[model samples]
Target: MAKPCGVCAGVRRAVETIERALVVYGPPVYARHEIIHDRHAVDELQARGAVFVDDLSAVPDGAVVVFGAHGVAEEAEHDCERRGHDVIDATCPLVLKLHKEARRLADRGYDVVVVGRAGDDEVDAIASRIPGRVHVVSHLADVERLEVADPARVAYLLQTTLGGLDTVDIVAALKHRFPRLATQDGDACSAVHDRERAALKLARRVDAVFVVGSGSAVTTRRLLEIVAASGVPTRLVENAGAIEHGNIDGLTAVGLAAGPSTPDKLVDAVVARLKMLRPVEIDVLDGVEEFVRFRLPSRLRHAGERSSPGLGGAPLAPGAALSHDR
Candidate 1:
């Protein structure tokens, strides 16, 4: 049996809340980017009448646009204002905290090095927040390319969803180059750390580990990397169909986990396939449990204020607690 990953479960719950509210409120709920980076989640929302758009231009003038969980660049927020689209920012608060931290570090005259996928919406915002002060690096080797005015004055910030062990090694390499380089506390989200730890633990108990996640999900890629780094046989599959018969022919134990953005249903399908294949025991390794909850935007909190009527309805209130579907 496949269990829901904490992070994906939380996001799934959040998406359900928004969809239900839209039902009470009407249609054309324009979402900026995949709501949680899961194709299944996006497809489900689309079936329920949510329109996912990559660019703000797809949204008509005065339409309501909801931001995805990964968060958007400040420029995107400004564009929404300029375009007159009613904005509902669903950026995970943990990511927002990192963006703010990166900006704060940049403002203090320190050069910043951001470690993450280049051109990612979140990375772009972190770079934009500091402009000239920030440089992006995806691999550990790229750390040598940092062009800082003073190595001593440089600080490193991470994409909140990056792999935990990978960041440790990357940061170690950077510190070797610049011993005096500053760093922030708890940059990666607790959820990412917890899931990575869970994967590692599960890896020890199984002959092979299968990480179910979308092809483009950054965190999912990291999970695969982490498992492979342990020298265990690991496969990263987008769905159960990718699971070849030969891969699981003789494995007595198999470990299963999904990245933060994956859907619970896809993971379940994978587990079901494994169950049918043989008598292997499925296990969930004990790992960190996170209790963090992100507050919804003001519009989603209160009943009196409706999300602007034209797009769908009026905005939700600031302090409203969304219903949890999981």
Candidate 2:
């Protein structure tokens, strides 16, 4: 078992916000992107009346539009507003913090360096905020080729889901070349740091490791990379069905980890499947404990109040409306 691995607070908040909106507004709530990266989560919400779209234009006029957990480009928000659609911001607060930092760094005359994959939604959003001043770099080589206005006045912001070691190495390269580069005080979010720590520990003891999450989940990929780097064999599977018996035939110990967007039920199913395959000892490693909870947006909160009676009589408490079994 892997510790500090499962649905994260941000993903939970985003999903619950959409679910509440579905209960209150009825069918056809439009989401700008996948509410979170996980396909199962998106499909569950789609069944509950959430329509995920890649562009705002796909949504009908006057409909309620939701921003995804990864955040959206500024122009996307502007387009929604210009079209007079009701908007609900479901962006994770941590991502929002990075957006603010990017804007501040650019406004303060610093050439901003964003460390992340080029086409990732969150990376695109941050880079779009301050186009001319911000440059995205996924590797140290990208940093080396950067042509900034002033090397001495550069600030770096990492993608919230990057592995700790990757971020450190890239930052070190940037600092080495520019000497005066400014960076965030920490690596990714506390949850990411905690998961990496637990994965490293588990890798040291386990014969093999499994990461359960969608292929697109950056955090899950990061965890897999971290564990694999420790010289332990690791595989990423989306669910129990994806796990093959042949992979773990003779293994007595296996480590399991999940991304922020991975549902708890999916993780449980994987565990149950592994047990059925053969006799094995499951031990959840110890890691950081998270207590963060983001508040629902005002519109969603009001909608919840208006629709609470039909959803079991009391006020809808965040994710209370979601059907875990689904």
- Using TM-score as the measure, which candidate wins? 2
Which ranges in model 2 have alpha carbons more than 4 Å from their true place?
185-188, 243-248, 275-281, 302-326
lDDT of 1 by residue, 1-326 (tens): 12335244335434754575476455778887777666766676787778888888889988877776667777888888999987766666666667778878887888888888898887887777775578888888888777789888889888866766767777888899889988775645556777877887787778888888886887888888888898889888787877767888887788787777776567767778877777656555556544443444555555433322211212334554332211
- Candidate 2 similarity to native, TM-score: 0.85
Question: Each model's TM-score?
Answer: 0.81, 0.85
For 139-198, candidate 2 gives per-residue lDDT tens digits of 878978998998789998988777677777888888899999896544346666677887
Q: What is the C-alpha lDDT of each candidate?
A: 0.70, 0.77
